[model samples]
Target: MNNMIAPSILSADFANLERDLKRVSEAEFIHVDVMDGSFVPNITIGAPVAKAIRKHIKGIMDVHLMIQNPDMFINDFKDAGTDYLTVHIEACTHLHRTIQRIKEKGMKAGVSLNPATPVCLLEPIIDDIDLILIMSVNPGFGGQKFIPYSLEKIKQVKKMIGTREILIQVDGGVTLDNAKEIIDAGATVIVAGSAIFNAPDVEQRIQDFKSLML
Candidate 1:
């Protein structure tokens, strides 16, 4: 499996988003974080921005829905060109239906969990998902400290997905400091926002992260 780097758009400058996206389009995936104040403490972009981003980015749009009632908007996000639509398990009351909706719309379905959420919650539908997003830091913000327990969480999820082969994604606080540890712990994809966008050399920083896994 490929060790991947997904640069989160939350840290990208809203003013020069096109330019910033162009810089990181070379990475594995372009992560779009959708936040609603009701679900998280902050509010970020919605369908309009996602549609605009879809026009500019060629890589897969890993849309992370940090919003409430994600199922209601899954089709719209898919129409907005989200290659993979991930809904928070804490936010979805009917996870199976949402996952089915995503698949029905021809997009890969993913489930995300906050730091406090348990990996065992996915046991019933482990094979139904294409990706599992593990929040290494608390959601709603970027560049926070990587939680120590996240490593164990990744290990647990990995064992669960064994042979079934679902991609394990680690988001938040993903940096050179813990990239290798997380990947070794069973994460195939790493989503880094401030770590990449805030770096002086975006491509070089991504390369540095890739080096650690190699």
Candidate 2:
């Protein structure tokens, strides 16, 4: 399977976003994590910050909405220059409607599943989504350890999505050592946060992850 690397901005230096973004210029996408205190225990950037970051990034703006009631900000994020907008299955009451709404806004629609959520929950709308994000660790925070079960979940999702064009993305705790395994399990996109940003050499770390795919 072909592999792509997405450097999550959750672990980037907020004080110097431009510098951090520059470090990962080789990445295929800049994974922006939008967190709301209501849905998750922590809070992160919103549409405005995302828009600002969008201006400086050379790669695609892959925005992952970790907020509750994501429908309220779908249009806002689309207008803010999001290339791909992903929402959680647990958050949306009307998931199909939300996916349609995202597609209507001209952004690729993606659905994310938490560690505890089963891949079977996505069976109904799998065809409607452009991407599927499997969270290896609990959402809301970066630098967490990768959950071992997530590998099995990726395999199951890949089997469920057999022959489809959807992208299988694995987020949280992705590092040089584990990225190959994640891809071998059938993930096409890998979202690495602290593994890339917190590394002593950001550019090399990004290169290392890409080299694994090569």
Candidate 3:
């Protein structure tokens, strides 16, 4: 499978978001992190910011909603230029219904799991979604240490998804140093924020990560 690099905007310079977005134009997807203080801790951007930056994204607009009652905003995000909408299983009371609603809005749907969520929990809905975002660090913040055991968790998710074409995405604390191992464990999409935007040369840092894709 072809691997992809999705640069997260959570670590972007909010004051210079449009400019920061231009820096990672080389990435395969622009990872939009929509956070609500109730679900995690920090409150990030909403659909409006997503719409503002949509024009600058060269590739897919991968919107990950880390909030409660995600179904209520599915239509709003779709209208905001979200090409891919990922909702947290922990947040969705009726995941299948939420997935249907997202697809109904004509956007590709994905599901995410917190670091503590088990891979088996995905068995029922594995085939229904386009991607599975595996969190390597605790949700709610960036610049944190990656959990060592997530590698094995990725492997387990791979086994559970055997032969399915669904994409395996790894987010949180994904840096160049451990990216290879994460890919080897079956992550097709790598979501990095600090590892890319935090670099001295953001574009070059994105390229360095892309260099390892093959």
After superposition, the stretches of candidate 1 with alpha carbons farther than 4 Å from their true spots are: none
Please give the distance, in angstroms, between residue 148's alpha carbon in candidate 3 and its true position after superposition.
Answer: 0.9
Residue 39 lDDT in candidate 1: 92
Question: Where does candidate 3 clash, by residue pair?
Answer: none
Locate the minimum summed-lDDT window of 10 residues in model 3: 119-128
RMSD of 3: 0.8
What is the C-alpha local distance difference test score of each model?
0.91, 0.94, 0.92
Lowest-scoring 10 consecutive residues by lDDT in candidate 1? 205-214
Using lDDT as the measure, the top candidate is 2
Candidate 3: lDDT of 205?
94
Predicted structure 1, TM vs. truth? 0.98
Against the hidden reference, what TM-scores do the models get? 0.98, 0.98, 0.98
User: Mind giving the per-residue lDDT tens digits that candidate 1 earns over 7-93?
Assistant: 999999999999999889778799999999999988999988999889788789999999999988987898899998999999989
lDDT per residue, candidate 2, 24-102, as tens digits? 9999989999999888889999999998888889978999999999999998999899999999999999999999999
Tell me the tens digit of each residue's lDDT in model 3 across 1-214: 8999999999999999889989999899999999999999999999998998999998999999999999989988999999999999999989999998998889999999999898888888887889899999989999998999999999998998889898899998889999998998899999999999889999999888988888
